[model samples]
Target: ARPRVGYYYTGKTGGTLFNEHMKKLTVQEFQSIPVVINDSASVYDAICTMFLEDVGTLFVVKQDSILIGIVSRKDLLRASMGKQDLESVPVSIIMTRMPNITTCKQEDPILEVAHKLISKQIDGVPVVRERTVNDQTVHEVIGRITKTNITKAFVHLAKDELHD
Candidate 1:
């Protein structure tokens, strides 16, 4: 059966809320989980894993899970072409620092996120949260949201609406 259009509108409206009422509607509802690496991990390893995972970017995090930097496929490829020794070089040496990284929260509006992706020319955003656990600082990684996910969600919602 064809999907219902009103259902899609209702879903979109519900997904647009940025406050506590914003429910986790789908994988698109949350930021994409940042693919991460350690500071000491080899650049070659980082590149290989990212390719295996089929992701374009990876986040470099400390042992404590504090976000440190990001590395993109382009960055890795560029580094590979340079004098840098991928097997010996650490990800920290090639990563883009935190000052340049863009992130989002789980409660953020999906539409706003879509705009950010377009304006920033980024494929995805990392979802993060800060919380205290046992009197220590902790970062909680919730999930990942991507442009493909958004498009698929839109199409599914549209089809569902047409049927209704």
Candidate 2:
């Protein structure tokens, strides 16, 4: 007697099933709502926001929520240990400024963002979209993709496999 085997997904064209296809999942599937802070906000403000949101990273934005920078736990720690006063030091001075911040779109593959997180040695990336206003283009943050989210998705996939 032969053992029975269950298939995950079967396409109409009889394409590959399971087969590492989970990498095809898009960022929109797993991304979480972003925690944003204004560029002019104080370093103390950034620290408080991080604790309140329980997030490792914060996207720095301008008026209208246009992304201008990114701040991390490491940045805040370094700033706090420095000579500047945390209550008076602005986040813009410590954040990774524009043109250097890495971002992804909603339709981007989650696998791609995961690779970027590893390669760039960062904890997360802001999910952004371009908007046109009066003939000018700007990037507005919509969500955030983080290592924790990826791990959660991986666990979900493993659970599915076990049940199958």
Top model number, TM-score? 2
Evaluated at residue 138, the lDDT of candidate 2 is 86
Q: Tell me the tens digit of each residue's lDDT in model 1 across 1-164.
A: 44666443334454455332323343444345567778789999999989888998787888766777778888899999998678999889888886587777776666666778899988776676777878965565555567876786567656765685
On a 0 to 100 scale, what is the lDDT of residue 144 in model 2?
97
Q: Candidate 2's residue-wise lDDT over 1-164, tens digit each? A: 33456544344332345635676788999999999999989999999999999999999999988999999999999898888889998999889988899999999988899889999999999999999988988899999999998898788778877887
Error of 2 at 122 (Å): 0.6
After superposition, candidate 2 runs with Cα above 4 Å error:
1-16
TM of each candidate vs. truth: 0.73, 0.86
**Cα-based lDDT at residue 130, candidate 1:** 74
Superposed Cα deviation of residue 67, candidate 2 (Å): 0.4
Which TM-score value belongs to model 2?
0.86
